[model samples]
Target: MERSFNINSPAEFESISLQIELKNINEFTREMNLNISWQALEPDFNASMKRFGKKVKIPGFRPGKIPRDRLLQQFQPNIEAQFMDDNIQKYYLNGLQEKELVPVNQAEISDVHFHFGEHFSFTAKFEVEPEIVLPKMKRKTLDVQRMKFISDQQDMDVAVDQLRKAHARIETVEDGAQEKDFILCDLQKLDDSGVPIIGKKFEKQLLKVGDGSFTDEQKEKLVGLKPGETARINLPDDREKTSSSPYELMVINVEREILPEVDTDFVKLVNPDLDSVEGFRDEVQNKIGENFDSRSQQSFERELTDAMITKVDPGAPPSMVDNYLSN
Candidate 1:
């Protein structure tokens, strides 16, 4: 939506003219077309020159001693550019005030035209909070599902196991790599002729077997690989195709985490407040229950929001979505 209008000048400036056009790019974005007659800017330009004259240095004369005509002759373009840069936002705000608009973001100024004796015109694009109108409810009450949190002994066990692994000690293993083992290897991409490609070799790279981004097939190949042993594995192509390419992986060392036993000493080490394994298990269970409750509540809220959005279908600003996804 766009509309052309003229902003009324103050009674003091009878010769000044302001032409404004308001354009709506979306529900929350707007562009303002602003044009001001040369009569409106001439007085400000003269005042700006006086301010600049007091500080600007000249070779033949002391500060503030240069004539206005001489200064204009020497630096008219620079002075005009500087004056515009310094006061463009002031005029933009004046236009916003005249139109009774509240911008949510900084205005993006573009298509600026400034002629010393003609006019000064520019376009300013900015975002604003959308006006929200609540629709009349079809029913007196809304029926939303309430989600409940549930946990079991198995869940507690898994959570405890994760905590144990998180604090586990790491040691180099001499035997073959197994599940949950880290393999330090040299991975070199192979060409069609079964030779290493130049500049495609990566050394001392650490890969965790049976976990992370590796596929099941990739994990299987690394399971029985021992130090000094090499294997060829097919990995997904970098070009995002279904085809695979072979790479040579030579294991330099095998590393595994040594988890502590679930004893009184271990429980004390994990938490000073808990001296017994039973107490530690109870704390872990409570934490797991809290986590489950949080997840359940979030899921419920998400579903409810989706349902409401489906009913209303309000427009979401693209900038807000981009900011959310980036963060």
Candidate 2:
């Protein structure tokens, strides 16, 4: 692409000539070769000098009134460097606009060639979105099962229970462990002979009696186990083909979670505007419904993308993937 335009200024040296040669290195990658004539940049350099002159401070000379030659002698190198850096980025953007290309990643600029009185040239390589050709549909319409999320009273009860648990305090228990108790214990993996394995001990670990992974048998083993007592727990092991391994858990301390009473006071503590427990429950229900709706939408989008990808497998550019992973 080649174009010439005059700088929007009264003192014009000549028309600014800019040429961009775009090349497709691949379906999703492109390289741009840009060249700009010296006449195009001369007016900008003079304008830049005037802009810099207003801010330049010199000894024995008033600001913005210093001799052009004296100012250039002191700050010409710095000014030229800033000018080139700024214009290089500006020209690169211009090239993209001229070619109507949207890069998915930052361009890798190389082979920069510029001098004070000569033409400027540079090369930029960047990644672009790949063209996708969708396959013809086997059916007339897509068959997608839309999930309708309904928040019922049972769901609200569970959400309220979770809130109560979140605000629950831990209290040291004097009796035997219960199903919801947390026990601080030391676990040592045992061999077939019921002997502790060396270097297989974990200390100061808190084990919840009612953890989701705990089976009924495991809960039975944990229940009624008091401090200073040991329980043999058979846990599933992925490393062994035998499927399970035995571990001796020595209880150090038992703690119980004391849930707060859900009343007007608790509702006010949860949200200051709410004066009634019923209002707080309604807010919680609304939030739960919103969360379910968001999750359902995300699931639908993911399933739709997967179904489309099975037909149109448009691969992503490495640079785009790298950028996504880095972020």
Candidate 3:
């Protein structure tokens, strides 16, 4: 790409001209090789070091009093490395402006090389917006299942039951564990060989059954377990941070949950906004309808999105999405 530099060039840009070679990778991507010259960078490099010397602590000399020659000898390499990083983007941007290329995502930079009093150059790959219109396309009429949320008498009764259960009294059950039971157990972390790792145990951890919070393996071993029973649980390696680890759980005690009666008194306690059970049931029905309406809207949006995606040009590179996510 040959274009004149219109933007005011920076003082460190000692090059009278910049060379930018743009190679088309595809309809939406390009590889740009930019060559920048360093006519006089030593002056700026010295000034930057002088400012840094005031802040950098040295053993022999007080801060800001290090001799220029010694300072240059000791920190010159470090300063050069920083200068390349600090100025590479500045030069790349300048070249991009002159050539009028607007990249859609972060450019992949490579082959960077620079020398004092010499030229600095690098190559960068960029994903650009392809200049093409989405062609007219059609698909069989999408059969989005029209969601209907009709909370009848049975649904209202179920909602009331759940509300009552949420305010249930917690009691200790000596007759083994059941659903909605809180178990007090210790989780001991283990190595790959199923041996307990010392100092990695979690003690007195409280877990609620039927909540789907514990791993399926742990829940399966725990549901029928009585007090004083120990279950060796092998957790799955599905978590992002934790792998499959063995745990020896000594069930200290089991607390069974007893739900309150879904009567006038319980309805008054849970639903203070509504005075009677009839009003509370109506509110639950409205909430269910609202949820179904929201889901229908989302489904319609997805249909439109799928249609537009099918209309896009086949040349649209898959890396475009991957590149955007990485950036």
- Candidate number that wins on TM-score, 1 or 3: 1
> What are the runs in model 3 whose C-alpha is more than 4 Å off?
1-21, 35-79, 93-106, 111-113, 129-132, 136-162, 173-180, 183-252, 314-318, 321-327
Q: Per-prediction TM-score, please?
A: 0.68, 0.56, 0.61
Stretches off by above 4 angstroms in model 2 are 1-19, 24-29, 35-101, 106-125, 130-148, 236-244, 286-327
Candidate 1 lDDT score relative to the true structure? 0.80
lDDT of each: 0.80, 0.80, 0.71
**Which candidate would rank higher by lDDT, 1 or 3?**
1
For candidate 3, lDDT tens digit of each residue in 225-249? 7778988876555756365667788
Model 2 lDDT, full chain set: 0.80
Candidates, ranked, lDDT: 2, 1, 3
User: Compared with the true structure, what per-residue lDDT tens digits does model 2 show for residues 241-319?
Assistant: 3588899999999999999999987898789999997899889988998999998898888777776886687899998
Q: Which 10-residue span in candidate 2 carries the lowest summed lDDT?
A: 1-10
For model 3 the local lDDT of residue 228 reads 82
Cα error of candidate 1 at position 50, Å: 6.7
